[model samples]
Target: MLRQAQHERVHEGFAVEAVDLVKEFGETRAVDGVSLAVPSGSIFGLLGPNGAGKTTTLRILLGIIDPSSGTRRVLGHERPLEAAREVGYLPEERGLYPSMHARDAIAFVGALRGLPLREGRRRADELLEEHGLGEWARRPIRNLSKGMAQTVQLLGTIIHGPRLIVLDEPFSGLDAINQARLEELIRRQAREGATIIFSTHVIAHAERLCERIAIIAQGRVAFEGSVDEARGRLRPIVRLRTRSQDGSWRSAIPAAARLHNGEWVFELPEGGPEPLLKALIDGEAGIETLAIERPGLHDAFVAIAGDAAAEAMGHQEPSE
Candidate 1:
């Protein structure tokens, strides 16, 4: 239990806080000293490759499983389940009774979260209709396609109007269309003042949806901060296409610059590009194309967590 003053300090503007959290299996440590602060009404992402302890950390935060060590507070409660009615959780492994109708399934989940059955059913119907699944409301869960069934489960997750929502790999198995829909839904929920924390191996989803993120790798936090800050780990890259193959203008290019498919690619210089641009012009380099590109989230992840982690994120390396 946290002291009143300490708890108040930690929860001032945060919906969830975990400190030095560690979860250990018999012979393995699944989560190693994970710490996170999720601000109220923010979309926070736990990003990592598979088996990186993201799920374990989330489960610990929600009090679904006791951590081997460390403390966590969710919605002002040290015991997260005490705030169950105000929190919604969508686990990685989705399940619904096959015999249950879609609406009933959603309402049942809401009821478990303390919503009245009648109101839950009403909200379930409204949600299904709004999400273009009204016709399937009465259909059995098993009767719906996988994507539709997943949608129903997602609707059920928020039927109780939770103040804090945790979704583990919410975009897994979703098609491009459904993935976009889920992203919009998440944004809407955050706009309405719900604090959301979702875990995903797909860095692209995190890059697109989250304002802040934590990158977990090998059961440890590799990095944690705002998305822009993550990208700032690497300098912007300068890619140039010039008419001349080799000339005095080449001296102006960074020594580390490499030729790749007819383009000179290198990190932007600390002094900026103006000097280099002037040098190139004076030397008649005939610059055809010049692009200074900021590092993307994928690049940042690779830099922070290594190539293996990037590969686990489902992105292929550029072929030579």
Candidate 2:
């Protein structure tokens, strides 16, 4: 499969491709007709609420489970496991031998993927030092903090120098500092020519790290494309707060405007903000604050996936 990929002449430049993939457990369909194409050397995100089948889709892509129907390719290999040596995966469920030393655990995982024990140990040492865990390298997993253990496990995932890295909910249990560090690491890896695919229910991470994203909801893909394109689905918003409730100035407000926390928030209508501002000023509306709000990924997600899915994911209402 590797050879075929090398000589196939047709280059879609895709690091991973899942076409109409489906997974079923009894009568329940976990992932239904999910299709994705992740570009090479890019950071991609699979975003959705809990039980949205993101894990199922990833498992199928990793060859951990077979799809009920459809096909997929990893690193251009039609058979995903055929490219196993070139891929690194960190599952949502994390585990490390409590008694094992941090460095040794990394080495062991590397060794399983055909990296020599000595070389693995050497790389583990460098990775630990680079990630600010130099003093904890030889510490037992049981003694390490949760953040440290997760870092070690991540180092293990990449110790073999895989070109493709897949992380499932990598930021779930991390503190803000650790999450920022992980985001930096992910960007660095992509800059070094590694394709990264991470799944998360938290939209913030995807907004910060991903160049391309897929929003999965209710066992299906709700949206897929560049972050800018997703946000483009909605128009710019205008939020205004006034010092007084003047009924005469109400005409300046668009019909779509909603009252929230003493503010009038609404999408800018056909004409821009200038006309509205002019009308408000002419009407002597005591404007306390007026600002144009760019629609964010969260707004796009709500628009694409619907309110129910957003609510299930605990996404705060836009006014918040």
Candidate 3:
């Protein structure tokens, strides 16, 4: 019994854990039985389409809003905000004061989290210089471009050096270059022992950064696991291009094969590539190209969450 309890604790050792969370506003249910266990010191992603309850779930986890049902623990405290001093949150809405200077803006936000003003200002200057905003430290936010303003706000969010950083749609309006920079920053924070939880409808960013992910659709979790686990749920795909596409080679094609741009493509059958190769050789298919490829996170998302949800992520703005 002691061994079993120890194993459970190891499995349940999470930076944030929510169980059967639900929220309703008026006649609409914003979240439905949502649950997640975000691993400590890991870059975890909450993924979904717009209006999919991702923001609501994050709010509940941060104690910004109460769930109608269920419970949660943040940083081992039964109450989510009990650990607020150790958490940093950047909401989807940008709220940097246009008239505030960049350095002062960071210092102000940090102060709200119990950081001393003098130290906040010092850290703000160092952070700005490190992130390539040194020359603009004194510029007012209103004078900065969209990307610059966004980066400054992100820096403010982390200025207090929280152990867990929660970001809601952090990449929503960033250009490609800025997005890349943000990705690097998130990774660096994780390396320094901070846990990062970010929500995004865009899958590519999560694919690049997160060690584990939860896919939400219509306010429900469709799947949650490591990237490798998600991809492993799909069979490898094979593409073949033969010298001829005649009736003689029909026997060589798998039952699931489909023709695309004059090439035959299909998910690998249960028996594996050896059987397929033998079939092609015996049939004299005269293959010009035979390629077997692993599926990616996008493919896994489509398979788990359906076309509509996948399309929402796939069509996310380049800025995202």
Per-residue lDDT over 242-300 for candidate 3, one digit per residue giving the tens place of the 0 to 100 score: 88667555765677789999788998888998988888877788889999999999999
lDDT of 3: 0.87
Whole-model Cα lDDT per candidate? 0.88, 0.88, 0.87
Q: What is the TM-score of each candidate against the true structure?
A: 0.93, 0.89, 0.92
Q: Candidate 3: where is the Cα deviation over 4 Å?
A: 1-12, 246-252
For residues 88-140, write the lDDT of model 2, one tens digit per residue. 89999999999999999999998988888998898899999989998988989
**Candidate 2 weakest lDDT stretch, 10 residues:** 1-10
Candidate 1 matches the true fold with a TM-score of 0.93
2: Cα error in model 3, Å: 39
Which ranking of candidates, highest lDDT first?
Answer: 1, 2, 3
The numbered model that scores best in TM-score is 1
Instruction: Estimate the TM-score for candidate 2.
Output: 0.89
Flag the better candidate by TM-score, 1 or 3.
Answer: 1
Clashing pairs in 1: none
RMSD of 3: 5.4
